[model samples]
Target: MGDVVEMTSELGFKYSILASGSTGNSFYLETPEKKILVDAGLSGKKITSLLAEIDRDPSDLDAILVTHEHKDHIHGVGVLARKYGMDIYANEKTWQIMDSKNMLGKVDNSQKHIFSRGKLLTFGDIDIESFGVSHDAINPQFYRFMKDGKSFVMLTDTGYVSDRMAGLIENADGYLIESNHDIEILRAGSYPWSTKQRILSDQGHLCNEDGADAMIRTIGNKTKKIYLGHLSKENNIKELAYMTMENQLARADFGVGTDFKIFVTSPDTATPLTDI
Candidate 1:
């Protein structure tokens, strides 16, 4: 996940995981005519460096879309939007929380934009659709982007993906879903009981098993690429998460490399530019 590459010339759709995990999370997406970041959880400097590794400049980004108001997701949103003069889009509830808590410091009024849930947001050539998720934050949501008859879905920071959500994201060309933790490991870990309970709750993060089930419910013939994102640093191991998903999918007769490829995103590095 460390190698950097130049943007592809033939790209109708491409994306890279700038970083993932509890420490920080961000995604970089490119269309033929637009560049956008899904989240900016790291410092502005760190995010800029990650972009530079992939031959991207922060200023080149057209928009910054927020999934929630959590610090890990909005840490760099304000800084990047202010420095680059980029639009910041989020649902009204999320925007209200951020503004009330001053989570994003002083973004210009013009740069602030609101989007409705379950509605389509057109950003350049990409048609973006957002859906609510079971998260602790007020009105947390995930997104699916469609372009050129292909779709790419990015889902994380959710406790579970409901049947309705599965239907909405089904049959996409690519998916980046959360595989946050291992249940056994989390129970055995040193986290306080309350914290553990919160994580295991319906409004907390998804465990490996649940994440696998969510994927199994969705994913149609059009699906080819999958990314395991937002893994826990202490409660889960990378290899364990990968094996859990692989074995679970295998039970359903879906071969990993044959049905689709899975890539694990890193908390500190950028994955290679991947085409959707």
Candidate 2:
């Protein structure tokens, strides 16, 4: 938005989602001195190529943070970390569970870091808070990254947002929230009943209705942008997801473009780098 407030009061962090969906998921976060990735779901080669799209060097990454052990979230974590010699952080239970399953192949012990939920972590000038999320995976978390006075949250793969989740991310300047499916489209599609039920379940994914409602509740007055993400290719179209959220904002008397901005992420490619 031309007149909407940006990070004028303080320094803002850089953010971009390399991919977000059933196929893969990743987000890149950078402050002035630190560059980090959240999840390496795509192949290592593909991840690097996406980095090249933004003129970023994978070798320069400072760390990799995993949300969970799902293949779509961790498929490339081991390969990328080993190649770049960077450390990775995950909850201890997730780390132990993933390690036992041979998910990441053989990362060195030193490369593995454990961060408990509800703790404040610092990397350079960046401040991160990892809060528990309602996902099926063991010890899943959604992250909010802050630098200076601005913050953004990379939130996905959660079945629902709890009061705590809403509280943790309500003040972010930007949000990458999951808008996984359209309920009507999903129910009318050809998927089996069980698959549909699973997705509709609390531990499955967030539908467009719930996602939009969450966005409406969580955004602070100064929140600048909201990116609808993790859409299902089979059930949800990007336009539908975007419009659903936009309509919600409009219904609340908020100007969609002038008061705030919105973007949708693709399953196939990375979104343009976002300045928070």
Number of the predicted model whose TM-score against the real structure is largest: 1
CA RMSD, predictions in order: 5.7, 4.9
TM-score per model over all chains: 0.95, 0.94
Q: Please give the CA lDDT of all the candidate structures.
A: 0.91, 0.89
Per-residue lDDT tens digits for candidate 2, residues 47-76, read 999898888989999999999999999999
Q: Each model's number of backbone clashes?
A: 0, 0
Worst 10 residues of 2 by lDDT: 1-10
Residue lDDT tens for model 1, 97-197: 99998999999999989987888998888899999898899998889999878889988888888898999999999989999999999999999999999
- Output the lDDT of residue 274, model 2: 72
- Look at candidate 2 and give me any clashing residue pairs: none
Candidate 1 wrongly placed segments (more than 4 Å): 1-11
